[model samples]
Target chain A: MDIDQILDSVSPIHKDPKAILKSYIKEVNFPKGHLLLHAQKCEKSIYFIKKGIVRAYSNTAENEVTFWFGKEGDAVISMKSYIANQPSYENIEVLEHSCFYEMNHTELQKLYNEHIEIANWGRKFAENELLKTEERLISRQFRTASERYNELLKNHPHLIKRVQLSHIASYLGITQVSLSRIRAAKN
Target chain B: MDIDQILDSVSPIHKDPKAILKSYIKEVNFPKGHLLLHAQKCEKSIYFIKKGIVRAYSNTAENEVTFWFGKEGDAVISMKSYIANQPSYENIEVLEHSCFYEMNHTELQKLYNEHIEIANWGRKFAENELLKTEERLISRQFRTASERYNELLKNHPHLIKRVQLSHIASYLGITQVSLSRIRAAKN
Candidate 1:
């Protein structure tokens, strides 16, 4: 999609579209296997994927967990660090060659300042992120690994096709061996 | 501090003081042990505490997990549900008799548009929440019960002093007995 379409996709709830869509956005492209944003860096901008895929994950001492995956028309950033103005705890890596429109923190604040519609969009995004996080937390708290895997398959089928099995295993909080067994059982 | 100071604290970040201290913001007081926001209902606005404490916890089938504790100068709400216009999964209960400015989602969005500083502040707050959640996830992954308890002690010394052991236990992903043991060991 072109810049205008991308901006339009920014939010349907926008009432003051003209004010929010300021002229600061710049579209950029990245090659596959590239790290668009690294962990431990403070993010000044949140990326909007016009055409591409990116994965957000973090490595602890023991292992890594895939926090999320972003596809076309999705927003990708290490949300916590980006919002907190602290160094990010998650690594955002490009999974495929992609095109993105960058909206830096200052620009977003400008949008928030210029238009209530933009602030509303931001509020909506925050709420969306919260729901997704809550769902992950609850699923981790209650669901069995197998159940989660099934739900993931039903909801984000493209993830299975796009991501490596190891990342999938990490995301599910299970061993690769367990995932393999599950896959075999299904077959 | 007075309302001016509060407004001042927000001005550098939100540029416009009038937009933030807008008409929707009315003063509200909660007695100790009052519920500010309830689970299973849509939260219209978030409360910004001028003084006192509030707890945000979710009720699972087996137990309740205390995830958030807001103090003076902190904003409290069923954040996920509040942002998303969905029913809240967690409830905010006032732990200390408190005074706060109650601002709903719509009014806050309006404020963000009118005041750039408020929008920046909102981002910072969201970032803080995200960082906390990431820390919680990592703590769950890497820390022992004793380690987690110690981390909590170091991070939120005041929380230990103000809240019940049961709530702390839930927050730390342990039992009250474990907290008692940890406390005993600390001494």
Candidate 2:
């Protein structure tokens, strides 16, 4: 989806569409396996994905834990780092060659201050993110591995084909062995 | 904090503080153990706590998981239900005799439409909530039980005295026996 479609999808930008587009600096192509964000760095910008897939993960003492994935038409921001202005605990990695539009934090804040419509769009975006993150957190806390896997299958079947099983396992807060057993049981 | 103070604490409200106050219906003197919200019910309103503590928990197949706690001067809502307009997966139970100011969702949305300052406040509020929730989710995902216990003790020392250990254990995603051992190790 284009910027106009995305802006309207969240909340309509009734005024100053040009200003919004200008604020987003176009990034045409980022290679696969690239790190858009690194652990311990503050996120200076939010990226709107035009194509490809991205994953967010953190390196624990033992290994990496994949927590989230973003696809086309999704906005990718490290909420803690971006909003709190702190070092991020997670890294955002591109899983496939990607194209993006980037908005610097200060520029976005400036737009929010200048335009009520932009501020409303931001409010809706944050509300949507909060809802999604809360749902994911609850699932991690409450659902069994198989239940989570089944729900993922029903909701995002494409992920099974696109994302690695190990990353998916980490996202579900299960070990690879448990995920394998669950997959076996499913068949 | 009163409504005015809360409003200014988040973002400055230059226009129509009275309307905002009118939108928030004052609710007072709720006794301990009162439930502000129940699992499976739609959250029609958001509550700003004036006094006391509140806990959000969900009952899973095995037992209850206490995921979050709110204190004085905090705004409490089931973000998933409130933002998505869905049935809540968590129950918000008051842990102490509490007083709150409530704002119905529709009224707040109306205010957001009419007032840019209100929209800015809402945006700031959502940003803060997202930052906090993201932090908590990361801790849950990556921290060891003992590390979580230690961090909780260092950050929220009053909680050790004000809240039950059982709820704290559940929040840490550990069994009560393990919590006891962690406490034993600490002392």
Q: Pick by DockQ: which candidate is best?
A: 2
* lDDT computed for candidate 2: 0.82
Query: Scored by CA lDDT, what does every candidate get?
Result: 0.73, 0.82
Q: Tens digit of lDDT per residue, candidate 2, span B1-187?
A: 7777776676667756556655566666688899898889988888888878899998977789999888877888877666778888789899988889887887787877777777888898998888777778888777788998999889888867889899999888888999999889866
Clash tally for model 1 = 8
Q: What is candidate 2's CA lDDT for residue B123?
A: 94
Error of 1 at B106 (Å): 4.1
Lowest summed-lDDT stretch of 10 residues in model 2 chain A? A14-23
lDDT of 1 at A111: 68
Best model number under TM-score:
2
lDDT of 1 by residue, A22-128 (tens): 46677899998888877888878888888878898888777788767787777777675556577877788989889998878767766665665676566556645
